[model samples]
Target: MNKSVLDASALLAYLNEEPGAEAVEKSLAAGSAIGTVNWAEVLSKAMEAGIAPETLAAELEKRGILGNTLDVLPLTIEDSMEIARLRPLTRP
Candidate 1:
């Protein structure tokens, strides 16, 4: 299966067990990645939910979602431009 790139919302939905989580889980299980910016967004949302960063990291690690399932990709200049170009069409 092709590796999928997960946005902040999709990861958040999976983390919170909300709708569409199953799809996110399937993607993760099949190998997926999340860009650094989106990972930051996930951290921000977790903070807003009163979860400490360490706790969140630990929880994800325990669930095998960190290094094993989801790979976090560092943002590059070209990636930034691409994200900007796709923002309008992708933003919820």
Candidate 2:
């Protein structure tokens, strides 16, 4: 099965009982799992929206999604420097 990377938007949609929840649910049903680096961001949004952490954890478990599988891809020092170098030209 192919792995998909899910950003905050997609995760939030599933957690919030939104329109795209079905699609996300389908993906999981088909064994397509998601990976993310920004877990704290996602968790914070869920908490702010009144989703109990236990509920979220249970849902993820039911969907066969494990928290430990999330990939934390941090920007390297060189990458950060490169972005900083290009920031001025790219800034709106």
Best by TM-score: 1
Model 1: which ten-residue window has the lowest total lDDT?
1-10
**Model 1 ranges with Cα > 4 A deviation:** 86-92
Q: Taking the tens digit of each residue's C-alpha lDDT, what string does model 1 give over 33-53?
A: 998889999999999999987
Highest lDDT, which number?
1
Compared with the true structure, all predictions reach lDDT values of 0.91, 0.63
C-alpha-based local distance difference test score of model 1: 0.91
In terms of TM-score, how similar is model 1 to the real structure? 0.87
Worst 10 residues of 2 by lDDT: 28-37
lDDT for each residue of candidate 2 in 1-92, tens digit (9 for 90 to 100) = 43565667776787677889787656545544343345557777778978876777677766557544433345568866896899999878
**What's the CA RMSD for each of the models?**
2.5, 4.7
**Count of clashing pairs, candidate 2:** 0
Candidate 2 CA-lDDT value: 0.63
